[model samples]
Target: MTEKEKMLSGEYYDPGDAELVALRLKARLLTETLNQTSVSDADKRVNIVKSLFGSTGRSIHIESSFNCDYGVNIHVGENFYANFGCVILDVAEVRIGDNCLIAPQVGIYTATHPLDPIKRNSGVEYGKPVTIGHNCWIGGHATINPGVTLGNNVVVASGAVVTKSFGDNVVIGGNPARVIKEIACSDC
Candidate 1:
């Protein structure tokens, strides 16, 4: 398989491959155009973002300094609002569901390197998909790690480093991110 195909399949692959580099360049150029725009040019910003992503809902808003690797692997649902400085390293798929609110400086990462030094030195890396269910709210500086699939209506506290997945309607926090409290979802 090709490096990109391997990467997408969660297998260790070379990131410096020509195809991957070109894809990353494309995403960078698009994100640069988006980041340079002023708030007054909302239409232009929206257009760029829409074109950059694999798919995006009609009602989507992202603040400045939004950057991603391989924008084609990122998909977001309707009424998604991402605050400033949101960085998504979408080496694999990164899917965010409807009505999600991502606070400033939140990083959603799908890329990960090998723990073994020999493998690491070989410059081989892999990726896993990240999925955030509907009505989720991620606080500022929070990081959603690779392979995590958060269920619906989840609330992530500020600065939390989420290493694992959780079911619906739970408020999670802390370094490794454990459920702090369960929210009552009368609507759900």
Candidate 2:
């Protein structure tokens, strides 16, 4: 299987493969466009973002200093907002659904290295996709790890490290992010 196919299958693959190189080049160029000072038009900014990333809906806002490893692997739905210092290491696919608000310094990472020293030294690694459902609010400094799928209408408190999947209509917090409580629709 190809390296990308292996990655999508949740298998370990070499990170230095040609596919990764292409993705890196694209990301670098896209980042440069995003960082340009002369681009004052909002349409141009949106178009640049659309060209860089795999897909993005209308009315999306990404603050400056945003960084990603593979922009094409990241997809954002409608009315999404990512604050400053947001970093997505999307070695694998990362999908964020509609009306999601990602706070500053939030990180969504899909890359993971082997725990064994020997394997780690070989530069072989694996990645898993991350999915955030609709209307979710991810707070500042939060870290969403690989293969985690958060359900719709979930609220992740600040500084949380989400390592697992969460069901819909819940409030989660703390390291490794446990569910604190269920949120009622009336609270909205």
Clash count per candidate: 0, 0
Q: Which ten residues in a row have the lowest lDDT in candidate 2?
A: 35-44
- Measured against the true structure, the TM-scores of the candidates, in listed sequence, are 0.99, 0.94
Model 1 lDDT at residue 112: 98
Q: Specify the poorest-scoring 10-residue window by lDDT in model 1.
A: 37-46
Q: Show model 2 residue runs off by greater than 4 Å.
A: 37-39, 186-188
Model 1 CA deviation exceeding 4 Å by range: none
Best by TM-score: 1
Native-to-model Cα distance after best TM-score fit, residue 107 in candidate 1, in Å: 0.7
lDDT of 2 at 150: 97
The lDDT per prediction is 0.96, 0.89
Q: After superposition, how far is residue 186 of candidate 2 from its true place, in Å?
A: 4.1
